[model samples]
Target: MDFERTNPIERDAYKNFDDSSELQSDIRFDQVETRLLRQQQDDEYLQCLREDQEREQRKTQKLLDIEKLLANLCLDEEEHQKKKEEFVKMKEPMLLAIEEELSKLCLEKHERDRQKEQLDKMRKEKAPRIPVEPPAGLPELAHLAIRLPNGERIMRRFRHTDKLKDVFDFIFCYPNAPDWFDISVPLPRRDLHCEGSTVSLLEAGLVGKHALIPKRLRLTTDTTALTLRTTPSEEGLDNRRDAC
Candidate 1:
């Protein structure tokens, strides 16, 4: 007690000292603090792991979409190939068919042309021949008024007119028949005659057909023996030859 009185720090410490109170009160252990800090670090690590997992899922989805697109492209390419093959198959047959049709037409045309030529030759060979002169000379006065190629009126006369209609039945002769003309048919766009045009009888006998004149006829209408004739087309007038 005397020593405590002499030391002021010991007196204050003795005055607060309580023998009944406990020494440990609300104190945290170092091991427990270290464990809590470690738990906090683990929680941070789990959060980072979750974020990484979500990012990976998004990336995987993108890859799946790309794969699907690639698969569709492949399918489209296959379909295109199939369609192209089908088109070629269809086109080939059509082309062959068209070629066959063209060949058939060509062959048919050639055969028809050949037949036409043969028929034309037969008609020419079987056609009856005409004579350019009259038989006994009743009256020989024939004249031809022609519209020239230059659109001019040119007159020509043949001495005699022959009615060889008894020889050839198929003849288109109208008006005055010429001695050198037996058939006078107008060609299209050819104006060789007009209304009231006097075509000589002698020239009408020779018509469009080629004929050989047996002899020339003298005009007995006016006591004048002027050999005047009318012919529509004189294309075959020089075909006259002496008939024995």
Candidate 2:
């Protein structure tokens, strides 16, 4: 008991040293916890920044792809237009040649049509006149005495309603008839055959008694005069007179 009382100072010193060591240990532990929290925050921020950068890179790559596609489309369109122009140029001469040939064919066809028309007109002019029959049951008759180019005379009888073409046919069948001839009345100087074959004998005022003089056309220098003969019954002694 006396020894313990005498060492009180030493015991108090040891107690103070232990309290100081415990306080130091608590401060160190707090510092370590703070440092660990700050490090975790920094790591999270860095991860977010890396993610943002990756998104921006992907967006930039997409824009580049779109631009490349547009450029390729423009190039293809230009090439197509150039090919179309070349094709038109290649066909130009052939199209013009076809049009020219068509025009030439049209002109040739027109010329052929004109030549055919001329030929038809010439044929109509050279063709003989067609005869038409007279109306039946007519009592009146026309007596015609025709004088030939050689001063010979022939006589024939026809109905008043008969066409002048009938008289022309009768003369055309004669043995001594000229190849081409014209018949005329002397007093009035009216051409009968050249007027029209459709004219009736009554319309020409040749109903009763009439006389005609024939003039022959000479086709060559050696042409002969037309001569005609008639039977005694058909021959008339009537004097020549203009019926019209």
Candidate 3:
């Protein structure tokens, strides 16, 4: 039997081929590990970017909300101011009218006060005056007879120093005396009814000069005769004169 002989070169060549195959397999394993690590890093980066974008969107939305609230407050303030102005305009005329009415009332009150003052003055002027009393210790007295327009005679005593105004006040106090009349002396034809007359009875020749003897005198209205007569025992008969 003949056996085939193995060559050394061929055997070595086979060994080299086996070593190259193992090296190639180790390189492929390294490449796969590197690729896997790189993909994991890329995924982590994408996740971080998404989180930042969401945070920025939330911040922007908060700013927009604050701006909207500020705008609403501004609108409310403007509307309140407008309403206040409208209310003032509506009440202005009413306020003016009230002022005018108060002014008119004040004027009316003043006018009423003036009218009341005038009426009081007129009443005071029309009122009767009081008679002044005669002084004491006179030496003479006049027995005067006053005759009214209705033919009524009244007797009274008067002092020599009494003014004619006293006689006029006495007549005014009478119940049935006329409101307006004139007194006059008949023999001399002298009027004695002057307003505010200050002539005394002695000065008008109506008082007796002697004591304890009264002079007789007649005081008459417009329709009666006024006369002065004294007793014969009285002195100074020619000195008795009419002073009216």
Candidate 2's error at 78, in angstroms? 93
18-52 in candidate 1: lDDT tens per residue?
Answer: 43232221122223333433554466568669979
TM-score of candidate 3 to 2 decimals: 0.30
| Candidate 1 global lDDT | 0.39
Best by TM-score: 2
State in Å the error of residue 139, model 1. 5.8
Backbone clash numbers for all candidates listed? 30, 0, 0
Please provide, for model 2 over 1-244, each residue's C-alpha lDDT reduced to its tens digit, 9 standing for 90 to 100: 3546658887778778889998996566445434443554466568668979998998799678656644544347688677556656756875897799899989867765664454344334433443333444457888676665444567777887777766765665454554345676643446665336667888877776566655454332321221111111122112211111
**Poorly placed runs, candidate 3 (over 4 Å):** 1-138, 208-244
Ranking by TM-score: 2, 3, 1
For model 2, give the RMSD to the true fold. 64.1
Candidate 2 Cα errors over 4 Å, as ranges: 1-138, 219-244
Candidate no. 1 TM-score: 0.26
CA displacement after TM-score superposition, residue 236 of candidate 3 (Å): 44
Best model number under lDDT? 2
Residue pairs clashing in model 3 are: none
